[model samples]
Target: MKNRIWIVCLACLWLVNNGVFSQEVSPRSVFSLNEGWECRPITTVSKKALFTPVTIPHTWNTSYSEGTILYDRKMMVYQRPLEITNAMKGKRLFLYFEGVNSAAQVFLNHRTIGEHLGGYTAFCFEITDQVKEGENLLEVWASNAYRTDILPISGDFNICGGIHRPCHLIVTGQDCISPLFYASPGVFIHQENISEKEAGIRVETHLSLKNKKEGLKLKTTVTDADNKVVANSETAVTDSIVKQPMLVNRPVLWDGKKNPYLYTVTVELYDGNQLKDRMVQRTGFRYFSADHEKGFFLNGKYLNLYGFCRHEDAKGKGSALLPEDYKMDMELIKESGATAMRLAHYPHAEPMYDLSDENGIILWTEIPMCGPGGQAFTGLVDTEGFKENARLAVKELVYQKFNHPSICFWGICNEILVSDGKKFVEYDDPIPFIKELNGLYKSIDASRLTALATCVDQSYYLGSSDLIAWNKYFGWYKDAAPSASKFFDDCKNTSKGIPVGVSEYGGGASVNHHQWPLAMEDRADSHFHPEEAQTFCHEGNWESFAKRPYLWAKFIWVFADFPSYMRQEGEVDGYNDKGLVTQDRKIKKDAFYFYKANWNLEPMVYITSRRFVKRDNPLTDIKVFTNLKEATLYINDEKIGTMKPDEMKRVIWKDIKLNEGRNTIRVEGKNGRGFLSDSCEWYYIGK
Candidate 1:
C-alpha cells in the first residue's frame, strides 16, 4: 500500500509538470446548429415582431403552395440559444454561416460580433470571447433588400431572404487552423506544376495562435485514393503562416468524366508532439486551356464541353437547398452524360462544388453582378462602396473555393452590358469594371481562365477576359427561328481571335401546352408557351453548336426550372420555365432527351412529343431521339420506314399515317450494342 501511494504521488507530479491536469481540450469539435431557431420578420423598427419556430435551411420568400409569391424583401431576426459547457470553456469558438442573403449582422448575448455582406459565399466570426458558461443568446439580422452597395443590384433571379443554408459551431484549441480567412479551410494545396511524370505541390497553411508557444510544428501529408501516403513534410511554424513543399511522381490526372482521381491532404498543427488542430482538404491535379480555333483541351486532350446552366432556386425551397437536393441534381446531370455545367450568375453552395469534383464535371462559377435583360441597364452602380463590395465578393469566392479542381472558369459578370441603356450609359461603361475583375481574378489565381457572358454584339468587351460567351434568345424573342443558327456565324466572324461560346440558349416550355405546327410568334414573356417550339428551338441551336467546333463551350439556358419572382410566363407564375426539367424535378422536357441522345454513349431511345398525346392531323412526322445508328418508326404495330440518325442524333419519318382513333406509336432503334424500343400513344382525329 505504501509503495502504491508513492507511485501515485510520482504520477501526480509528472502530470503537474506536463500541465495535463490543468485543463483538457480536444483537437476540433464541429456540429451543425441547424435546429431550434426562432425567426420573425421585421417590417418596421418600431413594430414588435411575433416569432415562429424555423429550421436553418429556410427561405421566407418562397410560397410552398399555389398562392401568390410574397417576396419578403425585408429584414428578419433569427435567434437561438448556444450552450457553452464547462468542458468547452477554454477552447476557441467560431460561428460559421455557409450562406446568408444580401447582408447579415450577428450578435452574441446582445453584443455585436460581426457582419457580412454578400449572399452566395460564406462568412465566419470568432466567438471565443463573446459566449458565457451557460445558455447564451445568439441572434442574426439578415436582409435581402435591394442594396446599391451590394452586388446584384438587379437580377433576373430572385434574391431570397433569410439564412438559406446550414450553420455550424466549431470548437478548437487555442492554437489551431484559422477559419477566419474568408471562411476557407485555412489550408490551400497549390498545384505548382503537374504532368504525367511528376507533380510539384505547395501546401500553405494559415494558423491562429492565442498562446504562441515555441517548438510548434505543422505537418502536411498527401495520400492517394487508396490511402497510401504519397508525400509528407514537417516544418517549424515560425509565423502564423507555414509553407510545405511536396512532390509526387507519376501522378494520375483528373480526366473529365473518365477518371476523377483525387488526393487527400491532411494538415495537422502540433506543439511538441501534442496535436492542437487538424484539417483535411481534397485536391486533384489537372490542366486545361481553351484554343481560339480548336476549342477546349483538358490535360492536353481535346474535350467538348456541352452542358446546361443551373440556378440554386427550386420550386418550394427557393434557394434553401439541402445536400440531398444537390445530390439529386448531380445524379440527373451525370445521367445526361454532360461534361460540364455552368453555375449561372452567382456562386452556388459549397456542396455543389464538391459534387462537381466528385462527378468530374467542369464548372463555370460566377458572381451575381448581373445586368438587366433586353434594353434596360440598372445592374451596376458607380459608387466606391459598390465597387469595393464587388471586389470583396470576388475575393471571398476565389478564396473559399480555391481548392476545388472542378472549377475551370471564373466568370466575372453576366450580361453587364446590353444593347441600350435606360439610365446614363457613360457612368456604367462596365468594360473597365470587367477588366478590373478579370485582373483581380488573375492576380489571385492565374492557373484558371477568366470568362464573361454578354447579351449583345459588343466586340469591345471581347478583350476584357480570356474567353467570352453570349446569351442570345433569337428564336423566342426576335421572332426568327433560324437566327439561332445565324447568331453563331456572326460570333465566329467577329470573335477577334478570342474563344467564344454560347452561354444561354433555348426558350420556355410548358408541358401542358402543345401546338401542332410549331410557331415562333410567341414572346418569351407570353403566357402561351408551346412545348414543341422549345424543342424545335433547342434542335436548331444544338445543331448549329455541334457544327462549329470553334465554339469552345455550349451551355443550355438551364438544367432545371427555378423560381423567378419577376416572371409570369407559361403555366406557372413566378418561375422560369426554360429548364429541360420541371421546377419540382418531376418531369424532363423533350429537349432533355435530344441532348442525351446526342451526348450519351448508352443505348437509349426516346420518342419526341410524348406528352403531346392528342394530334389534330392524321398525317404527321414521327421524330425519335436515339443513340442507335438506325431507327424504324411503327404505327399500330406496323413498320413505316427505317432511317439513320442525323448528325444531331434525330431520326424522323415524315408523313406517317396514323389510325383515326387511338394509335399506338413505337420506335425500334439499333446500334452495335443492342436494340431498344420506346412506345407512346397518340389519339388522332382525321383532318
Candidate 2:
C-alpha cells in the first residue's frame, strides 16, 4: 500500500508539471500591501507596539509648502507589518522596493535584516532566513527626516514620502538570475584595419550566475547567417568565485550606422556535469573614442551626437510603471530620430538599459545629485556622507548596468556642485568637490567617459570632466534670450579646448488649455511666457521645442515635465503642465508635433498651436515648423509652388486652390542635418 501511494504521488507530480494543474499556477503574482498600513509620530512608538500599520513610498514630512525642508523631525515614524505563511518557506524570498524615500530600516520577526539609505534605485534583501514555516511578521521603519549626510538633501525636487513605487515579494529558484542584470549573455565584435581585409574579430562574453561553488563554464560558437560554424571555443572553470575583472578576447565587431554588424556570445555554467544556468549576450565589435578636439568617433568614423533627456514617469501611474512602459518610451525615442538619451537626473528603470542595448541608443546614465545646493544648504558639505552616497550609487549603477554597449557616458552630477543662492552657506570654489566626484566616477567605471552639467560658468571645472556639458538657460531660465547660434558659441568660447554641449534648454508649454489670464501672476517664477508654457502641455509639440538645438548635434532637454510638489501659489495643485503630455498622459501639445516633424524623418503634417485662432476667426494662420531647408507644397496633388518661411511666421505658397471635397496639403522640406516635414487637410464648404 505504501508503494502504491508513492506511485500515485509521483504520477500527480508529473501531471502537474505537464499542465493538468496549470490553471492553479500563474506566471506572476501580485502582492499588494497598499492597504492596512499606518503612520504615527516617531516619538510615539514604544517597545510593546513596535509594529504599526504604515503606507509604503511614504515620507515623514508632508507639511512643507515649497522649497527645501531640512529639519530633524524625529516625532514622525512610519511602520508597516506583513504576515507570511508556510508557502514561502523553502523558496528564496526577496523583498523588492522600487523606492524608499531617504533612509529605511527593515526588521523581520523582530530581528534586523536590512537597511537602505538612498531615495532612488531599486533594492532587494533576501528574507528566507527570517521567516518561519507558519506566520511571520515583517516590519519597516522609514525616515525622511533631513540629514546633511544625504546627497539629495541639497538638490531640487521634493522628497515626497511613502513607497513612491510598487513593492513586491519575489520568490524564485536558488539560482534565479537577478532582475537588473543585463540580459545579453555577452557580446562579440570584429575590428579590421580599414586597409586590411583580413581583420581580427574579438569576442567578449559576460554572465550572472548562481551556484558559483560548481564553477562557471563558457562555450562560444560563432556561425554565419547560414548557420555555418566559422569559429568556436570553450573555457572551463574549476572555481565558482567571481573575480572583479573578467575578460575574453577575439570578439565580433558591432559598428554604428555604416557597418552595423553584431555577434552573439553564449555562456553556460555547470556543477559537476549538471547544467546549472545559461545566458546569451549580443555584442558588436568596434572601438570608439570621444575627444575635445575631434568630437565623437565610432570605428574610426567621426559622428555628431544627437539625443534627448528622458524621464521614467508614465501616464496615470506616475513613476510606478511596468517594463512595457519603458519599452514603449524607447520605441518613440527611436522613432524620433534620436541616436542617444541622457537618463536624466538618475539611473532609469532597469528595462531601459535592455531596450537601449537592443535598439543601439547611446546612453548617458547619472546619479540623483541634480540641480544646485551643497554643504551650505544641508551642512553636509563634502564629508563622509557625500562620499558614502556617491560610492554606493556608483557601485550599484556600474555593477548592475556596466555591460550594456549602449552606455557610453556616466555623469557624476547635474549642476549640483556649484553654489546657488538656495543654499544656507556659500563656497568660493566648487572645483574641489567636482574633482573628487569626477575622480570617483573614473575609478568606478573606467570603460565609460565621465561628464557633468554645469549651470554656472565652468571654465575652471572644465578639466574635471572628459566632456564639457552645460545646462545654460540663457534663453529660458535667465532673462537673456540669446540666439540659438550665440548660445552654442557661448558654450564653445567658455569651454576652450573641452568639447562643449548644451545639456538642457527649451521652454515649457501647456497644450490646448490656455493659461489663465492670471497664470502669469500666479506662476511668477516660471521661465517661459504663459502662452509658450501652455504649448508644452501636450505631446509632439515638445519635439518642436527641441528642433533648433538639435541642428548642432549636441542639444537635449526636451522633457514631458515630471511631477513635483514645489508648486507656488495660483498654480495647478497636482501636475506640472510643462510636459509634452499632461500628467494624465492626454493631449499632445504643439511642440510634440514639431519634434515629430524633425525627428521622425518622414513626411508628416501637424498643427503646432491654435491659440492664434481666436473663437471668432474661421481661418487660422498656421506656423509650420520644419527641419527641411527647402520645401514644396502640393494641395490635392496640384503643384502649389516652392515655399519659404518668412520672418513674419508665414510660409509663402502662391496661388494654391482649395475645393469642397476632402483636400490634402503636403509640404516636403529638404533634409540638411536632420529630417523635417508637415502637412494639413481641410474641408471647404462654400466660399
Candidate 3:
C-alpha cells in the first residue's frame, strides 16, 4: 500500500510565517571561525555533552577508528561547542556548515534550534537568538550509523562520520543576503543562426528577497574580462521576486567544442542607497540539446561528452576537503583531456562547483541516494521522513549551487532500482519514490537535463530520465579485459533508443611502496580470516587483476586508492588500491600511465608504474587517445610519426623505439582541444 504524509512545512513558508523578522545576509564569510571549533563525542547521559577536543576540517571517523571499522559497529556522535566573541556581537549571526554526514542536530546553549537529515547538502541556522551577551555555546550532534529514516543505509565505501566539513559562524548586516538563494542567469541570451557574424543576446536575472518589507532595487551589468561594461540595466523592486531583461547588439555565443566563448553577468542588490549584495555569474549565450539519435549538441553542433566519474574523497582528509583540494582535483581532471565530470553519487562540496565554474569543466551532479537495497526503496520511500529529507536535499542543492555554469545536468539517483541481480534489467513497476523524486527535481530546476545512473537496464527505465546513464563494470567485475569490445557492443546495441553514457568503469591497484608480492595474501588473511577452519581463503594477483579493466572512456574506478576496512584481507589493511594514485598520494600505478597515455593531450613526460617490469621488453605498446588535429610520437629524444584521434576507433601506438637501459617514449598533440604529451621509460637486457 502507498502511504502519503507531509513531513515538514516548506522551509520558505516556515520562514515567512514564524513572525520573526527576516534579514538579508551575504553568503561570503568575513572571518574564518572554521579553525577554532572545539569538538567532542556526544555521550548517552548527555545528548549534548561537550567533552572531546578536535579541530575544524576534521572527520570523526579518521581519528576515532584505529583501522578499518565495520559499518555494523556501535553508533557514534560528534559534538562541537563554540564560544561567541565580541567581534560577532551585534551583527546577525548564523551558523553555516558545509556538510554533515547523515543526521545532524544543532543546539545553542542546549536549546534545539534546527536539525538536518541529508549529509551531502549544506544547511544553516540563524543563531542570533541563542547567543548570550559575551559568549555563546554552540553544539552540533552528528551521527552516521544506520537509521531507517536515513536514505543511504547500505552502500559501498565507509560512511566516514562527524562534521566531515568545515563549520563557521557567519556574521552579516541586518539586511544581509540570505544564504539560500537561487541565481538563475536564465536563458536570456538566445542565438538564431550560428554562421552569422552578429548574434542576439537576451539577459534574464532573478533576484530573491528575504525581507519583503525592505524592498530591493537591482542593477545588472554585462562586461568582458577587461572590466569594460558591455550592457547595463536598472530596475526598482515591485514584488518579492524580480525579473529584468536587456539586449546586446552583437553577442559572442558560447559553444562547447566548436567555439567555447562565455560571458559574465553581474547583478547587484541595493536598499535605497546602500549596496546590499552582489552576485557575479558566468553563463554562455548558446542553446544546446541532448538525445540518443543526435548525441550532445551545443549551438547545433554534435559534441560527444567524455569524462570520468569523480568521488568527493580526498587523501588523508576523508570527505572534509578544502578549496585548494578541489582546485588540485580539477587540475588533474583537466590534465586528463576530458571536458566534463560526473560527480558520482551526490552533489559535491560547494568549492567543487566554484572550481568547475572557473575551469570550464561540465558537471553532472546527483543527489546522495545511491545503490540498490530493500531498505532504500521499501523503508526510505514509503516513510514520511525520507520524503522530507529528499525535499530538503533538493532545495538546498538547487538553491546553493544553481548559479554555476559548469553544472549541465541534475542526476536523480545512482544505480538503484534498475538492477536485476544477474544482468541489468528494468524494475517490474516504476519506483513511485523515484518518480516523486524526479518530479521534485524537475519542478525545482527545469533548466538542465535530468539524469540517472542505472546498471545495464536501459530499455525499461529510459523513460525515468532525460538522459540514460549506464554504470558497466564488464571488464573488471564481471567479464575479462579482452571482452571490453563485446561489452561496448552490447551497450550500444541495447541502448538503441536512449541517450546513453558510460558512467563508471575501472579496477584497483595498490601502490608500489605498499606493494609486496605477498601483500595480497597477507591482506586476505587479516580481513577475511575467520575464527573457524570453515572459513575459505582465496588468493589472487592484484596488479594483473586491475590491468584487465582499463579500456573505456568512463573508465577508472577511482582517481586514487582510499582506505576501506570492509571485506579486506591479508596485509591490505584498510586500503582499496584501485586508484591511479596511491593512498598517501605518493605513487602512481601502471594503470595511471595507461590512462595518461589515453587522456593526456600535451607533449609531456610521465612515469606510469615503478613496480613490476618485463626484462628486455624496452618497447611498451603505449596507447595514446587524443581529440587534437594531429599527434606526433617520439622514442627517447627521436621523433616517430603522427596520428589522428577518432571517436569511432580507440588510438593505439605499437612498437615505439626504446633504448636498452631506460628509454622514454613521448607523444605531443595540438589543436583547439589544447596540447598534450606523455612519456614512460623501460629497462632492457639482452644475451
Off by over 4 Å in 2: 1-98, 142-145, 160-266, 277-286, 373-380, 417-425, 428-430, 478-484, 494-496, 512-555, 567-578, 611-621, 626-687
Selected candidate, larger TM-score, 1 vs 2 = 1
- How high is the CA lDDT of each candidate model? 0.86, 0.55, 0.58
Predicted candidate 2 versus true structure: per-residue lDDT over 428-481, tens digit per residue: 345676677788777755656788777666765678878777664433443333
At residue 121, candidate 2 shows an lDDT of: 69
Candidate 2: residue 201 Cα off by (Å): 10
Residue pairs in clash, model 1:
none
Q: List, residue by residue over 483-528, the lDDT tens digit for candidate 3.
A: 5555545555676565666566555544323221112222222333
Ranking by lDDT: 1, 3, 2
| Model 1 alpha-carbon drift over 4 Å, by segment | 1-26, 44-49, 64-70, 375-377, 418-427, 479-486, 671-674
Each candidate's TM vs. the true structure? 0.93, 0.70, 0.74
TM-score of 1: 0.93
Q: After best superposition, candidate 3 residue 468: deviation in angstroms? A: 0.9
